[model samples]
Target chain A: MQENKHIIELKYLSKYYKGSNVPAIDNINLNIDKGEIYGLLGPNGAGKTTTISILCGLFGPTSGNVFIDGMEFQHSAEKIKSIIGVVPQEIALYPSLTAKENLTFFGHLYGLKGKHLKTRIDECLELFGLEKNANRRIKTFSGGMKRRINLIAGILHKPKIIYLDEPTVGIDVQSRKVILEHLKNINKEGTTIIYTSHYMEEAENFCSRVAIIDKGKILTEGKPKELITAKGEYTDLESIFLNITGRALRDE
Target chain B: MLRLLSSIYKELLVLIRDRAGLAILFIMPLVLILIMTVIQDATFRTVKEVNISMILVNNDKDSLGEAISEGLYASDFFQIVEEINGEKITEENAKELVARGDYKIGIIIPERATEAIRGNVNALINKSFKSFNIPGVKKRTKKSTIDITIYIDPATSNSFKNMVMSSLKEFTSQLEIEMFFKNFSEAMAQLMPDQKPIKFDSFETIRYKEVYASTTENEILPNSVQHNVPAWTMFAMFFIVLPLAGNIIKERDDGSAFRLKTMPGSFVTVMFSKIFVFLGVSFVQFILMLLVGVYIMPALGLPQLEIGPHKIALAVMALSSGLAATGYGVAIGTIATTHEQAATFGAVSIIIFAALGGIWVPVYVMPHTIRIISQFSPLHWGLNGFYDIFLRGGDLMVVLAEAGKLLTFFVIMLGVAIVYNNYNKTK
Candidate 1:
């Protein structure tokens, strides 16, 4: 295993969905170093999810290659799966299960068992201020409570690299703050985060570095402040994104 | 390990927490069971009693004709109608009436029937032994055979025909034997020179045993109810599980499956856990309804059954077959894109399985090729298992081979489900 260094590397990774001429993700290269929050900032359909999904090894890229800590996804799928946690854009959680039960089940999938699984669940619940609601069914929970639990579900296994796809998509400010803060703290404790979102302001404030992509291709990449300065009078990351992606409702 | 167990625990918690869904899963099945049992019970009671309507035609104007008619009416075997048979009974008219299904049997006595019996009995014996040897004397002593035509409706059941035939034969044979004995005695007295004349007035002997009579008439009904009820119950139990299994697939499509996946267990473990839960639900529903049938319903005057060892064993085997059904549900759900599709597939599969399994009708009644096709469904095994227990008194071990076949079906379906989920994930 390639240890204690670069967590993710993507080179010439592209995906053309079946029966589609246009590719969802274009050939691009990037390296995600350890213990940093990297954001893939893009408009809808800008290959933001495609990139994160590739890193998670959900499916092989149509062409090109992805390596997690020097191991190819095709050859080291199980190993890669064990190390990386994916929090999808959709709230992927069992609504019928209580928070604790849901956590326990996911923990078991990662081969966790007994007291260790219970302790992890308890700790996550407490950290997210969800300890009191651990026994409450997820269907009874609010959207914010469910989002918090969703984040916690991925982190329970203590994966080295965690992928968050629009984690704060539809939550209230307070929930979003709590989730982002928890993610920041988790990253501080030796985890690499690759986040994707259309929230340019949040990406500017929370991410150490960001890439603005559109039409399945990256237009720019740098620290938000540096990029602002590089493009004269840009003033903010939103301006940079608007200048690059244009004003179009991405419905079709 | 612990994480996998926790995942299973969580899935079950979620599964149970949906109170409406849980209620439907538990209550709906029992309601259906109750309905099916009630219908079958009614059917069983209706098919057991045997009552046949008959037309009696008597042309004999003597006491012997009256006695024959009285004997048939006296027995509880037939319902005798007078208007259907006119004074003159013909073979053609009797056949036409019997074919209309209004009557089970028709009786026709020739015009000379009474005259023939009376002529032989009243004839005075010749006074000479020399005259007894004459051909004319022998011809005069000979008895005529009465033409009593008993027309049986071919459309009537085999058992009903047998009862009618046996009763008629007994009545006619007794009459003939009495006539022959009377004629022989008269002839012997006429030839005896030193014998006192025998008084035949007090010599009447009723040929058949007559039982103690009551005013109450025994009522008979059809026998289809009993055969159809138990047969349908087994079929309903075997086929109902398929639709419930579709609900399992609906949860997966709703994103609950992915949520469970991210938690800590193998999808296989969660799957097996659901199977266990569903199978338990189905089996419990089965036993509860049957208990109601055997115990509580009897208090209300319903026919209750005793739980024999064979019945218990067959119940256990039936449960295993239900598990196989759940497996098929899980597999189908995993492959379907939506709950509606899952439900449709469940319905379609159950119908096909029921048809093949001999639930809609018995395999014996089906053509040979269709019977062979029914062998592929898990329903067939389940229904067969029920038959072994409730009807045929078969035990668990006796149904093991069939149960094994169902278990194989369960395993294959489970494997397919696993492959489907994994493929979807990768795709």
Candidate 2:
């Protein structure tokens, strides 16, 4: 484990998917120190997920090594995984499993058990206003309800670092506020937060620093206000990102 | 009636939407029956195959030994494994073959089996002499007799012995009638001392090697419903792979799989849990299907699915079959990239196996090549097991052989699923 302020380091990471003509991510090097809420701001298909997946050891980069808290994924994947939580962009839950069952399962996955695990699940469910619906299957949940449970699922073990890929996407304003607030509360409690979103206003107010990526390349990386200053006249990240990466559709 | 028709209409709609489910619900069973019916008429005639294979020990080289050997060999209910038969098979070898489970039954025609024939003939001659009532006629008779020993493997169903004995009894009666006619011919010669001998040995019994395992001479009626019910039950059980694969693919495509990766358990743990769940589902499926087969079918005027004297054998069948189906389900479910892909692959593979395994057509009706292919199907082993207990009245050991096959399939498929999951994770 690294005894330094920076808890994560991505060194020259690139991912070329099998049979694909182009790499999903290309030569990306980045670092996020402890006690910072970082965001990867990008349009869809802009390699934001590719970067987070590598960071969480979901898949290995074809041409790079990742070090989480100075532990290389190749050597200490389990140890790294213990301290990192991942919230995937999709609502990743068993529709057949109740909220309590899902939480208990994921909690045990992170090595929680017994009354302590039960207590933690109750706490998480209560915090997300889902204590009443604990026994209801996740499939019956609305998009926002599922999103809240999804966030709670990732953070069950109180990992030192949590990565969320579009955690607030496609949810009601109330759900988005609760999720964003909870993410902030965890960051205050010393969890390093890395989130990605195309919503400029959310990233501007939320992340301490943000990297805007396009076509597998990072066009700019800085504290949001500083990036805005560099653009000379743009008031918010939307104008800055649009100006730097263009407004044409990037779907392919 | 309107509601019933509409319900069927709704079901059809659901099936159409589910390409995999539709194939299983209609295509597999229909294809199985069609293929078997076609094979049933084509050069493969209709002699029912006996599930029992016998190891014959004929030590007597006389006419009596040939009669015993040929009688069983010709019977539709018995398969005399010729490669292992002949005078070379000693009592010890026969016992060992049965004990080692290479064969379920062993029959020994003792070294002096000719005495059985001679004794009967002599008795007839003496009776003829007494009936003449001549002044100096003597009443002398042969007192020798040979015991035919049938060694049955207790591990198998007692029904096998019954079948063999049934055939043997028929053989004895026929032998007695022939000897009586031959003696009558001889008596005529003794009385007249002028006629050439009348041959009494021109009997031609039914031959059924072409139809394979002909049981016609034995008059062993097959419980067709028992065969059909368990067969389609297995076909349905293995089709558990469809929903299993669908669930896995759904999890994968929807991100639950990725969440699981970030969670603490190894991929093997996740796969095993799915298998365990499916095993439970399969067990329930077996019980309900069999309930319908045994009680409901008979109530509805169909042949009862006979459990015979081996209810534990049925339990073992259910347990092993459940695991086998679940293992198959877990394997394909994890390997397929999409739910439809998994469903298609699992359904098609199971249907092909069901057809080849004699689920619709009896294995006897298949072409020789297809019969050989059927052995490779786990469904074949399962069907053979059901037939053992139902038709052949086989015992525990008989069912164990089939259960062992299903268990082996479970182990192999589970191993593959685990390996494939880990491989995918690593890559």
Candidate 3:
């Protein structure tokens, strides 16, 4: 593999939130190659969101180096932001704006304009089976529709890398299928995907490579089938995850 | 530039769709301006148009009593009421009316006041003739002074009481001078009977004139419209905080702000866009308020607002004021954690600034300490700028200092917001 093949490099990434003794993410290291569907799987308070947030440059880690597309965040934040998209755990969209309007706004922020922006928005809407509701406000949308629109807003600029945090946590099965299938198509187009989710089975099937993280550290990291095979007693990724992270409650 | 324009467009769209917020941004200020202007106009008219009612008891019923009575009636400031309920008012009754607050002032002429004045004048003239060694001059009687009592309501302001007392003194001084001339002429006629008797009319040596100080040739007196128009307009402009801050809190809560933060440009771009949109709203609110003062108020029997001749200065002041108000809104929105906190603090803080800014009453009338505190309020700077143009007939140079203060306040508030936002992101 070429030196530039790895699109994202997280070297000793650690984060300690203000006024808290415990680190949210401690000395975590990962290198995500281009065109890979990578899942950061864990339970609540498992540092999955923290690692994703750092990768998306929503904030910087306390002591770490994050290199996105061979560029550092501090020196090339704007340049890095242009090539990446972020879909937060929340449905981050203006309820008053229509689906097309929301996509247009996000597209503008990403420096897309005119016919190109309009064309991209139309294509995304059609691909998501939401072309008919393009002019309808998000407030009038269903949970699944809103989630789809939120996803579209992030991907409108066709960024080279995308970070999705719980993208389909609360949605109908059909909407989830449509979203995951579209994500797969994007990933096939050489876009790197960094995803976080609590669904063990979804992660096992969707991610090309998976890392099960807990207590601010990764417990295991490998291809889903390989990880399951490595644990001979566990038949699937769900059993493997339970065996590694334990049944202890992490509700805090 | 494209980023800025697009962000501004997005903010405008979001603001337009929030109909309730739009109404609060526009109609609340409009109604407040109209209602407050009307209410204040009534109070202003009472002070400007109506006369202070006073009861007068003329016990002398002679020249001194008649002269004072005529003087009070001649002035437009006083409404003399000699008889109440069809009964002639006595000195005791006059005092009782004034003490009861039925009358703001009362004047009583002592019995034989005219005779006393005449006797004093005649004695002085006789003594002057005797000094000249003229024989047959009557023996000079002892000079006597008459005391005229004035009763004032305890509630009457000391300044108003002084004005009434000064007017009464003028009447008595004129009467005394005329009596002196008459008595001197009588003494001269008695000395030389052959000379034809000369007659004279009452004359004034000096006259007093009152004028409002202003730079322009035509000075606009401070009236309710002139005052309330700009006062409440500044108030309304600052009131933009409620909707502006509320919208920011909403964006933060809905996660759109976080999404924007992750976009291509700086989040400052979005903040600038919000400031521009809300600044436009404040300008609209200001113009509507001025229109109400100019057109609506006159129709409702109040004096039309005089915006003065410094149109350019007024626009500059308005722009600075709008910027300051929007900056404050952004600061509050950035600092507050929730919509409830933002809305409550934004509204209450603006109201406090308004009160201190002389929106309810002019700073000149406020207590000394409050007046000093008022200077710190951006609304006060804006109001002073408006007042300089409207009441003082000042130009751009005259209002520049106030405009500068408002602009400085804007910069400080914007800086605070930026710093607080940056701090929040790091934490």
Candidate 4:
């Protein structure tokens, strides 16, 4: 039943760091279909970033195999990487480079070049309202502006799959709205996205499906409303997340 | 390949826009060459006072010849080249030795030089007393004169020539006084018992009949500009570590390197791009510094730096030195965690290396221990390569060891950098 429907599959995924008894991510198994906005929701230290990082092949899981588009990460990393993009939680843009230059470099990295990449860059910048400051160095931009440029850098190639680790993190509501709307529009165009967020309300509204995780293990997995109804008498996703992952602050 | 090109292109763009960095790379070296040339070359130093080697051929074998030979052998200034055959060196052979190149000055003493000087003194005594009709002095007088021949290669420096000629005046003056005193002592003995009277040492007896046999190749001698140009240029090339390391550390801290990892290419591609960009920058630096040394220094009233006969050797040595410096830059980039850490660590360590390698001073001036110490420095290898071609007129084969050593150092350092980077970074 899962064949041909799921684009990403993780089998018994586990990651145990050196000198630590507990695993960072333990015995995880999941499958997400293509063209769906799948969210990995958790509090801090919930392994949301770690799962996304591994999915992007940032590092290997201690004991597991990840298959994306029917190609294993270990065997076909180059192919899988070419079709995927990652927007990390940290601002990954070069401060010395202008927004346009940064985008152009990322485009060339993904084998996009010539006038085609240029036109695509212009369209993306215009859509994000960053065309006005395309030539300004990222160091001169505001926090919100830098975040938007960072987002633009990841999508420059228009990858088939994008993994965003908190795309709207630490920005004003205006910048947040612009970023979320663009993401939704891209998703509507049939690109699969794996999004990790601590914002329960946003994930409930945005994700077609989500897995609530805690202590490196998934507690529940389903549609937000279904999971909300199933877990006790919680009326909303945020209360359900709190009741599941607990009110205690988890730090890595 | 296109990704590599784009990455290198971006690195070049960033480097070009760094005005302060470019100024340090270009202007500091050129300006330092000028300043050092003015200070190190302005003072006049004697050739013999600074360890000059010459061939000495003495057929006199007398006290005079012995005195001159001993002077050279004992003085720290002159280094005498002893003939291996033990045969008395002829004037012709001495000139040939000087002409062959490394030795610029040759000394040859003719036979009977002391006898000729003694005879001339007696004749002068007889003539002085001719007006008084001194019979015995006139009867004992013999007429002869000493002629000291100096065969020098015309290519010898004016200062060395002057130094050689200045010694001639001293020989003549000292001999003349001895001859005069000897004649007077003998004249006084005629009035006494003739029992080996109170006579001073004879001037003609201890006098040296020596002159430059001829000049040889003076091209190998290093002047101010030749010395300062290469030393300061290589020193400046290594300073690239500052900007290079700063770029690396900044990218790592700002998360650009991590982003690059998740992009299209492998880790090797990005690393190769950075190293290639640095190599290009170093090459440009080498060319610019050479232009200043070979062309600009002369226009500014300084001695023009020589590229010697083999221009290809110069080019090869320059490339090797640049690559070695860049390799060091790569290694420093990996080890340093912060910009300040990278900059200061590289700066201080290189400065120490330069100091210990005799870059700031001529290796000849270094003591035996320091000379041994200098052999371990990569800067010393590069400086030796430059010196071989610039000062020693060494061919490619002659300079191959220095260049090879530098290239080997480049390989080792580059290997360490790559492995260290691979270890720190996730695959």
Candidate 5:
């Protein structure tokens, strides 16, 4: 089922950082398909960021291969980058700029310009309910506003696949709802979604399929309902997650 | 094309948003230039009269000696402090006083000096009677025992020494001329033998106008206060703009820059656009400084600068050097890891360049090794360009060498920045 339907494939992907005691990310195999919200669920230090950063073409893997839309990382870095959008763990908006200006800048970075760029920015601002505060500086904005703008910056290019790293980490409930709703709409519109989060309930409802990972390796993965039902006597996705990834807190 | 637009657009947006950083970068330099100009104007005053207080040791007890001392004391030029008569003046005390700059001129008079000027009866008779063996003529009677010493102090007063010397020479010449005329009249009356002692009443009054010439090329000194202040103003502007160019690097470290890097355009295009922005900033800083120098300063007793076409050329050459240096500074700033490091590097490097380039001091006066070191600094070129304009009144051709050096610095620094960025991205 994974091999026939997958749009993104990672095969024997292993990363051993320079002069490190152990691999930052161990051998991991996974597949993500188009029009599906796939969640990589993990606690802290689970190599979630490393995996996302590598897939974004920041660097190459120590060994094995990562294929995006069947194009290998070795040859099609630029093409893959063009088709993919990344919303980083950090709020990547410039604090000095107005909310609208941040989006405009990001929009232009995605090759959207002139009146077309201006229209796209206004649309995104309206969509995020930030139309009134478009002219306000980002530094003066609330965390939720910055988070929304950060999300908007990544999606302005309208890539086929979007990768979001803990987009709701510090956002308010209302802002989180807006972000997940936007992600749902994007996924519905034929864009494959790859997300990482510590929130179990959000992954349970929002993600079509989920994988529990710990210590840089995947423990289990399946459709949320299927994983919950298959694990005997589990009432919800959290019970399934707790039984698999454990209840222990990860500390640096 | 789209990628280039995005890169440039992102840079413009960030620059606009970061007002605090931009303000410090732009207006702070202007304010600093203004403050420094005021301070430098205060410290570097025009070279004028050196005042010396001299103790006049007059031993001439006669009326004539008294008149000489009184004349010198009464004059508006010589500042004379009369010493109380006690012991004879010694060379040791005189040297100490002169070395300390306590006095301008020291006068020593030997005892029994009044007898030297007296014309003896025998001397007069020898001239009248045509006799070789007159008592006063034959006996070398009382060899004029006049020993006088005038110790002039060079440190305390250059002009005061000249003033006192002029007064002394004038007094002696006037007394000799009067004596010579008195003797001539007597001789004429004796020759005529019948005519009453020639009573020719004639008055010849010559009018002399006093002129105080301001050195005017006669003195081969350093440039007058007029040229040096403006030259330094330009230098200060160049240095003050150096630290602000690190915005490029600051943005890069902050993540928004990475977002821009991945924008649809070439990275080099974006870098070049930032260079243009900083160049504009440098231009504004230069103009503001020049305005203060050319208009506001001369009104306050600084040099009257009448700039011609050559001055404009030199100014442009200076501006070009500033642009090149600014370009280099921006490149260096981007290569740095943090804003603090970038700022520190920018400031320290500019200061080093300023020192090496003879902005702090003239290269001509620097040692050979230091002068050789100055060739590596863009600041030297900038200052030299300024010198060519205001000091030498030189054309573009005169500043071409300096401009070329600045261009080379710009190229090297820019090349290093480009290489560093490429290497850093992978790291």
Candidate 6:
């Protein structure tokens, strides 16, 4: 109420899917500041995707208020969407389309067009080291190239907030490094990055502040180093994660 | 606006790249129109131009048999075969030929059929003279009833049998009337002895003239090309459901749909883009089908498809039908959970609708229940709209009635898709 400076704020958020007795995400509160890299780490079925989905405005929470850049989703849905870019875990680009074509199409969805859209597409392809393969169909690309193109599509409109779900999953070291490097550069440009990952070490090093979430509840939230130091006998974020969420199988 | 256009352009690019989908969209329908037109052309000719074969055994080579043979020969409907293997066909042989399906009908005139008819007429005339108490009127006994046996193939349709029977009845009635008039004139001359014989001219009191029921001055008769062109075109237009629905399912499965949901503006932009693109595909399909109907069908020795002068009506009908098909595809895509489900249901459902809509067979020939159900099919409405223009010479107002139904179907299907999509999301 006192002019909250955070770029994103979630208040008592919960989601109970239809016909399910358990809530996917229950009574969660979170705050992500501008230009900060925030990682949400969780085990399988731990509600990471659900929380991200709600934040992306993919679906409304069962009971909660979501505010993005000081505006509520109810009143500023389009405005919020325009400012937020989403890179889903899946290779979201059309397989039959060339990398440039896929990028141009996504750019147009964000209202970018003509020479501007073309120039942006070319720049992204060049930065991703995919300029040579820009004309190649996505179906013809390797998994890493596809993942890179997927990332480029999300950031083509130069959004202020980027929500990435497992963006580095199932990709090679070279593609992952290039992607993380570019994402860091984008963050340096004052874009708030909210990312989810199963990689604990990566999250520990990459995220400025992190939240360990499981069973629809946030277990802890703080800077990675501070969190590591506070939790005695745990050397790194992986041990901290295993200790908190446990090593038991969450086959779901 | 740019988003819609860009999305439409994207969908077109994707569609153009899919060779299999392109073939299903263009080649399948063109080949279907050609093949179906060629196949149905024969059936149509059977009704219009081709003659039905009949076996004739004339035991009485007198007036009745000669008259019947001459009448059958004169009419263009029948090709009478009087012999087989250079041997005269007997009554039993004619029946066997008809029963074995070698011919559609067989006619056998009984022996002395003309004499029997003459004797009966003479007896009736003598009885009339006796009733009037004319002098020297001799009483005469009526002859046995003359039976002209007709053998009809069991496989022949009842309607065809009725037509053949009616034609035969007309011939026999004329012959009987002629015989009666001749006998009466002879008896009158004998009774009067001084009066000249009266000559009766064969003049039909009422004549039947066949013409197509149409609104235009120049009527285009319904033929195979006219029927198959629009029927299969509508079928092909609706067949867009397969590729369109498959595209949607692929987007959802691959997560592009989710990404789109997270994009600027509403997802309706994307759905509308698909609709716009696929609707254009449907139009292209319709046009190609018409071209095949007009040119290719005629080249294949089938009657030319006569699309009436109502160009605006035809365009309106095509647009509405295309929209309806696209809308259905979207609805199926939204409702189905997987590509297999969408493709199978889309294809089977379109075929079912086409069948019900009289694509495979005309609605008039369908059973009462199916015919009633056909009224509900979008293809039926589209086919009727085309028929109204092509065959019935209907104006814009008449086609609008059908186009309105098709557009309503489009709106309803779109609404269902939207509602289902939202429901799935919320759930």
By TM-score, the best candidate is 6
- List, residue by residue over B1-427, the lDDT tens digit for candidate 4: 8888888888877777778877786788667667776666554234524667777877777755666677668776667875748775678787777777757788776787666666677777767666677643533456765556666777777777788667655655566667677776776577465477875854345557754221224455567777777887788888877777787777778777777777766566777787788877777887888788778888877778776677788888888888888788878887789888888899998897788767776667889898888888988988888877777777787778988998898899889987876564342
Candidate 4 accuracy as lDDT:
0.80
Better of 4 and 6 by lDDT: 6
Report the C-alpha lDDT of model 5 over B230-263, residue by residue, as the tens digit.
4555565565444545566656666656655544
Fnat value of model 3: 0.79
- Residue pairs that clash (backbone atoms under 3 angstroms), model 6: none
Q: Please give me the DockQ of candidate 2 compared with the native complex.
A: 0.21
Chain B TM (all candidates): 0.63, 0.50, 0.84, 0.63, 0.61, 0.92
- Which model scores highest in lDDT? 6
lDDT of 3 by residue, B214-327 (tens): 988978988888878888888889878878888888888888888888887758899999999999999888888888888988998888998877889999999999999999
How much does each candidate deviate at the interface, measured as C-alpha RMSD after superposition? 3.4, 11.8, 1.3, 2.3, 2.9, 1.0
- Listed models, DockQ each: 0.33, 0.21, 0.64, 0.45, 0.29, 0.75
Give the per-residue lDDT of model 4 (tens digit) for A103-135.
Answer: 998899999999999999999999999999999
User: Who wins the DockQ comparison?
Assistant: 6
Per-residue lDDT for A109-216 in model 2, tens only? 677778999999999888889999999988899999999999998999999999999999999999999999988999999999999997899999999999999878
Question: Candidate 3, TM-score vs. the true structure?
Answer: 0.86
- lDDT string for model 6 (A1-252, tens) is 326599999999999999998989989999899999999999999999999898888888999888898888778789889999999999998999999889988998999999999988989999999999999999999999999999998999999899999999998999999999999999999998999999999999899999999999999999999999999788899999999999999966
**CAPRI grade of model 4:** acceptable
Model 6 Cα lDDT, one tens digit per residue, B1-427: 9999889989989988999878877898788778877877777766666788988888898888888889989888888899888999988888888889999999899999888888887777777777888752243446679998999999987767787788888887788899889878777778888888998888988989989999878698878787778887888788888888988999999999999999988499999999989888889888888888788877877888888788899999999999999999999999999988998998898989988988877799988988899999998899999889888999899899899999999999999998887787687
Q: Candidate 6: where is the Cα deviation over 4 Å?
A: A1-4, B134-143, B355-374
Off by over 4 Å in 5: A1-6, A11-22, A27-29, A70-78, A212-216, A226-252, B1-23, B38-246, B304-307, B311-319
Docking class for model 6 is: medium
Give me candidate 2's TM-score against the actual structure. Answer: 0.67
Please count the clashing residue pairs in each candidate, in the order shown: 30, 6, 0, 10, 3, 0
Regions of model 1 farther than 4 Å from truth: A1-5, A19-21, A72-76, A111-119, B44-46, B50-250, B262-265, B300-302, B311-316, B395-397
Error of 1 at B407 (Å): 1.4
